[model samples]
Target: MTVRNRDFYKGIIKKMLTERLTKYEEDGYKYSLQYNSCTNSYCLYYTCPGEKHWDGCAAVEASEV
Candidate 1:
């Protein structure tokens, strides 16, 4: 994956997170958005350089925090 692809995925994730965060805020839920990122090392069949993906993205839940 080229820089363009990496950026594209990042943008997508950002948008998704932003939308979700906005919803949470609108619902009067206070929380922090936290995400765990990891690379796809096991799926080597379609590996691309500089390509990264995000997983385990979740909110910290203000109540829990």
Candidate 2:
């Protein structure tokens, strides 16, 4: 990811946790919470608006929040 992308994601993550939000969307990116049965926990999932496939997808484990 580019430096801009990295910073954007980091900022979103920080705001999400601070505001205790389950979902957030900004600047063509969407972040949401999903359950991971294998991990037996919830994770934060984000998707870049224009990306295809998983190129712009990522997850943040609940523990990381």
Candidate 3:
């Protein structure tokens, strides 16, 4: 899928996101779907609330080709 527009990525991530895969919630956000430029993929990441870093766990990713 050639996802060039913002809406397409948003829909994919929102649909594929599974709450069971996320953890950590101390203050703010708990889940995120980040775009990896090197791999050209989207990865689901979890972090402690208010923090913007990965929680040291392997992420679930989907490549775009």
Ranking by TM-score: 2, 3, 1
Q: Ten-residue segment with the worst summed lDDT in candidate 1?
A: 40-49
**Per-residue accuracy of model 2 over 2-50 as CA lDDT, tens digit each:** 3355445556767876888878878776677555778755555666687
**Model 3 CA lDDT for position 5:** 55
Per-model root-mean-square deviation over C-alphas: 13.8, 4.1, 11.6
The alpha-carbon lDDT assigned to residue 30 of candidate 1 equals 26
Candidate 1 collision pairs: 1-48, 1-49
Better of 1 and 3 by lDDT: 3
Question: Of models 2 and 3, which has the larger lDDT?
Answer: 2
Residue 45 lDDT, candidate 1, scale 0-100: 15
lDDT, candidate 3, 1-65, per-residue tens: 11135554344365555443323342354545565777666665555545567663333345431
Query: C-alpha displacement of 55 in model 3, angstroms?
Result: 3.0
**What lDDT does the true structure give each of the candidates?**
0.32, 0.62, 0.47
